[model samples]
Target: MSTTLHIVLAAALISIGGCGDDTTPTDTGIADTGAADSSPTDTGPTDSGSGDTGDAMVPYVPDWSCLGSVTTGTPTAATADVTATFTDFGASGPAVGASIQYCPWDDIPCASPTDTGTTDSMGMVTLTVPTDPDPYWGFVVVELTETRRHEYYTSVPVVNDATPSALILNDAAINVIALVLAETQDYDANGVIGLGALDCAGRVASGMRIELTTGAGTAFYATEDGTFSTSLTETSTAGAWGVLNAVPGDFTATAFLGADSTPIGTINFRVKAGEVAGLFMFPTPDGAAYTP
Candidate 1:
């Protein structure tokens, strides 16, 4: 009986040991879900150089405003007076001696125009329109200026369509066409001789007077229609010799046509001493004075 009991006890102990060996503990410690979340991962906020972590931002703004006359009008054809005034929005106005530019609209390239004038003491600029009439178009641009240092410009337009009238004079009053005196022939004994003639369009008044003043201070008057010749000679008279001896200067010849000695036409001539001079008259109307 004792031996049987020992065997059973030994068998029971062996069975327990086998069961423990079949079911061993895993030793996993903790489940591996992902990497550790150290330092909060920093995903919420980013470094944008300004340290501005907020999502909102401010916008940018511009500095200048356009100021000038933008009105349109019809300007006078002969003379269109336009003016502009510039005032400083800032503390001080433009520096003294600073220049301004003005331009018209029809001008090509519209970059620069011939009609530019300077500013006055009061920072005001004035420009005159072209003497001739221009066709109807958009605004005329006037550019006010500053140099490259600080470039500033303004534009103004003058609008109008009425053309100015031209000056008119009576045609009958314009009788004499031209007056001329030329160096035709020079003589060693006579010094210098010049022929004088009057160019008339219509009938010249009878008893008209023609006066010729030579460069050498020699002067003569003629009442006839054809031609008159005079010579510069050394004389004893004070004004006479002084004029004849001096070098030839500019000569101004005048013609009085009407009975009251009204000036019909006056012409200019360049005379040189010791040279023969010639003068021609064109009785045709609207004849131009020429030098040969």
Candidate 2:
């Protein structure tokens, strides 16, 4: 009976083993499936100088120091192309192979859809601007031949048709020289230097005047006083009388305080393009003009 019982139990165990499912275990580390991965690692290109890698950064160089402009001497119409002449101060002649981009003046980071061009032998480029009832324009020029980045700013007017070249009328060359003349008067006897109606040395003065004379002075904005006299204001709020567009040459500056009969000082100063010359006038002890 015992032997028979043992045989039956062994048979039941064998039957249970045969009924079990046979399947292989899976790996949890790396998935192995029939479908392909939709999101793979990206190995795409990036912009230059983005510092993607943890390496030492390269220094940047400037492409241009200064630039100029040229227009058709007319207001730019919406359908017309606005032309400009760009020259570099560092270069002796025209800037060859330079690129020009037209953007809105308020644009902080100039974006795409930019009208672009390369400078020809004359360093001139034409940009097509869209027509609008009201338009304010800005420009950027890049010298691709040089490794460094450089840009300049100037006004671009948009009109219905080509009128006259008025763009960059006030945007003179950065290196162009200028002159600043200051008048000082001491109202109180305290001897504290201040720009006032009276000379610090206690001299009574009447109407004050400043004159800058040069042949090229007329080319820029000159006063109606026969080019010898410039626009003048009596208030000391202006700080100084200015000759902003003085050409490179000898110039005579005269200042008078008190009455027209009284002259403050007449001094000669030489100016170079792209530089600034300063002149100061004070009353002499004998009521004459002196420059210090």
Candidate 3:
């Protein structure tokens, strides 16, 4: 692959602004970027059609294969403090008295809680979970009667980090997500894909565009406020990106400036019809821009 690699598409161990206000979380250690360019960026999302790369408009074909995956929540611990916050999307507020549980990533309808807690006045609960050398894929299970459904499940990438785990609240803004639901809506188990572009330091990004490798007409984008856009001219922000009604399966996507075909890099991930997946976007390590 002679093309310079700029961005890294990783399974958001800490998906979509996963970490809350903590600015100094360690590097998450994303790697294999080829001489990342120190350029200015405005990250965006991908959807159904290809942007004009100024070429012959041949269908976009991803030149890169799947690379190794990166998991954060590092400096593994035997036990860690995992904090989960429950929010009320309709009212734009936090909840009180919500319940939570922990389960291994492979478990569904979790057999039982690995650890448990109840949200306090602030809707936050800290659970002590044992950690391992590798990050835990699925942990915190949130239970709240305020939403359309009584349960919300997520993978806490910050589970292994010494610091408190990232906030596992609902996407709250973006809709059509397989897993993200609002207080006013019914839970839909249909498939959808979303991305939260950010810097290695955990800052959200905007202005870049994401494209599906399949050209399957599944592209979609949204802003921080949760509105959706399918126009080729709109750029996706750290706010949101993905296929609203996606074709479920393993998929590949490339990141680039809005409407331009030059890729920052390619990301690989799987999306089942009924789960929420957030893809993390990173620019070169020099802080080219953000998700900084």
Candidate 4:
């Protein structure tokens, strides 16, 4: 079987497509990528403007009070112990330093007062009050200063009631002597004659007596304790004895047995030159040579 051959040839066709279309939109929110926006906005630190803000500091205030007591009879035969305490009002902790000043209530110049002291957690101070024959009154003032404020405390009126039994001779012109007499003797003795007797009897007399003398030959006499104290306004000389003007000279004080002038004993002493004089005397032994 014979078949007819037919050949058909088609040319290769090539078509070029355009670039792909871009549909995704570009970013407009970025500052550099777009124009600046005009909307108003809040920034910087947050501000609520409320009352419970910042730090609160406390203010300082001072309030003080004083307490005091007195103990009678101290250093002197009659003296008193004065104590005072200074405290702060509403103070929970210990107080700072404090000062206390005391003076005679009647004294205007403030003679001798105690010094200031610091409180030892407890505000307290004590001082000695001298007793005087004349009534004395005084006050205690305490002061304190802190970083915040100043405070002051004052005590009520204080008085010294003690009385001194021993006489104080401060005068330079006066000579002082103390004597304790024996039970057998009735009078207190002093002067040179009293001193001589004190060596024998051991005990003297206690008391004071005054007398006047002309410094003449007339011998001055003391009866009680064999003490003789006499003041001479002018100087004079009697026989072999010579007495200087206003010169206090002590002589052997002699006590007689009775009005008969029998010599009992002599107390020896020297007079102090001045306005005042003191002497002590003692009892003498029997049969002792009595020379007037």
Which candidate achieves the best TM-score against the true structure? 3
Best by lDDT: 3
Separate clash counts for every candidate:
17, 23, 19, 19
- lDDT values for all models: 0.24, 0.30, 0.41, 0.22
What does candidate 2's lDDT look like per residue over 113-156, in tens digits?
A: 25788778866667676654344344343544531233332112
lDDT for model 4 comes to 0.22
Model 2 ranges with Cα > 4 A deviation: 1-77, 144-151, 154-156, 160-292
Q: Which stretches of candidate 3 lie over 4 Å from their true place?
A: 1-23, 27-76, 149-156, 159-194, 207-218, 223-227, 232-235, 246-292
In the order shown, the candidates' Cα RMSDs to the true structure are: 50.0, 37.1, 11.8, 53.0
Candidate with the larger TM-score of 1 and 4:
4
**Between prediction 1 and prediction 3, which has the larger lDDT?**
3
Tens digits of lDDT, candidate 3, 110-181:
686677788888767776655565444443455556332222222123344322222232433334232332
Give the higher-lDDT candidate: 2 or 4: 2
Residue 73 of model 1 has an lDDT of: 27
Q: Provide the clash count, candidate 3.
A: 19
What's the lDDT of the predicted structure labeled candidate 3? 0.41
lDDT-sorted candidate list, best first = 3, 2, 1, 4
Order of the predicted models by TM-score, top scorer first = 3, 2, 4, 1
lDDT of 1 at 16: 12
